[model samples]
Target: MTDHLNVVLHPLVQHKLTLMRKKDTSTGVFRQLLREISQLLAYEITVNLPMTSRTIETPMTEMEAPMLAGKKLALISILRAGNGLMDGVLELIPSARVGFVGLYRDEETLQPVQYYFKVPDSLKDRLVIAVDPMLATGNSSVAAIDLLKKAGATNIRFLCLLAAPEGVARMKEAHPDVPIVTAALDERLDEKGYIVPGLGDAGDRLFGTK
Candidate 1:
């Protein structure tokens, strides 16, 4: 195993993470926090994206300014909870193409069962950022990326609100080429397959369900 996974740790992200970790935080607060946090994390994740220079008039003369030059990025959300985080990231990158991956786990089989998936054409040429709110078992996240690769996504990055250590390791072993960006890495998963000390079921909190 690599000594460390390539994870982005930012200060604003840390503070927002602390707020989200609190048990008393309300649903409204939680949603807002997720949006703000996702935007900050998105900033960190997109820092290294390839850029090209363009000449623009600066009141008097045209000078070269670096700008994202290639195809608009692709934001693939892993359904429900991922959509919440996607809202914030989209606020930052408004022009990014959006996609959805819908997978429901089969209780008896203990495997991800894909229900729906749709992505933009020419994914191989665009920078793809696949996001979800939580990464617990890593099965669904890894599977989602596998589907993206199958659809010709060459440059891809995974982003999430929170992650467990096991999930991190799982992704590393299964998809080493894809770097992961998360707000916080929590403790181990509980017997029920939930991240310990996590913000509880992300979908539940986002949707106000049990």
Candidate 2:
């Protein structure tokens, strides 16, 4: 079985994440760091992608060269906060098909409310990757993945900058087949459902909303 949770402990990824976690990191700097770290995560997540060989001429010789086998990819951003994380991944995988799931959490119930959802066609043919910077309660992430599966995404992976134990447990219970890759796994979530030691709200930090 695939390891359900993967913490990218690469020194570079961890270093950048630390900088991102600081409270005073400027929006521009935070965004740049996220982009850099995101590219690294993108590299890690795609390491084992299926490959096929294609005939190609190198200088003066014809040879079979390896290339990705299936559809380029379907990158599903779990809206708002997810948008912050996707741009960096996009920079690395420019050919990937992009989609968005718009969900807002209701404070009282901490349930996800979907306002918008759209994804690429033939989702099952592509390796779908869902991006969300913070996996705090896992409610939004789980709901987003549920919707993606309903839309025909069979091969899916979850990517995030930080993950809480509660969120990781929630995802494992809900979608064990989908592996999760994150920069760090923090201790737990607070009463307000925020990840402890998390860099506040990812969307707010990314967009300067708060």
Candidate 3:
């Protein structure tokens, strides 16, 4: 994966994402698919995590074993929709520290407005992976990253279920250092700022809201 973006096209991830994109899929099923797919995405994003070795005693004999190097990861959910992906990633990395960044879009300017923000301590020492289900307009995602940077987070990665060309370009321009990992990259954002061929409002669909 390049330092810019990594699109996970594994068969299982693609299959589940296809289900998520279908307009008729129910909320429960969509939630389940998101959880399953997030795990797969987690695997891809963490491929190069530093590793260390420790001596351990097995049932047979004492030997050196491999373990993750450095402090526990900080998983920063970008708000309500990010929670869907966060739960699944937490399942895989149960010991990870969790954080939240809440943002809502302004109807007038279509800009992101922060509502809440909290993150784990020593963000600079840990790998911070920001989770948001859909990278639609990239405003909120970029804003959340800004908060993280202000909080002293340097090592950061962005995880999303789907991304649009517009969103990717925006993120690349704003924070080229942070890599983006996603299941699929769609065509473009519609006039309303929703991803085209993208699953409808991720937060709304995940929570059965209008």
Q: Please tell me which predicted candidate would have the highest TM-score against the true structure.
A: 3
Using lDDT as the measure, name the better of candidate 1 and candidate 3. 3
Task: Give a tens-digit lDDT track for model 3, residues 98-175.
Answer: 999999988677799999998999999999999999898899899999999999999999999999988999999999
* Candidate 1 lDDT over residue span 1-210, tens digit each: 132344456778888888988888899998999999999989978988889999898998889998988999999999878988999999999999999999865656546789899999999999999999888888899899999999999999998988899899889888888988887788898877789989888888887887
Clashing pairs in 3: none
> Compared to the true structure, candidate 1 yields what TM-score?
0.94
Where in model 1 is the C-alpha error above 4 Å?
Answer: 1-4, 107-110
Give the alpha carbon lDDT tens digit for every residue of 87-133 in model 2. Answer: 99999889999999999999999999999998999998999999999
Q: How many collisions per candidate?
A: 0, 0, 0
Assess every candidate by TM-score. 0.94, 0.97, 0.98
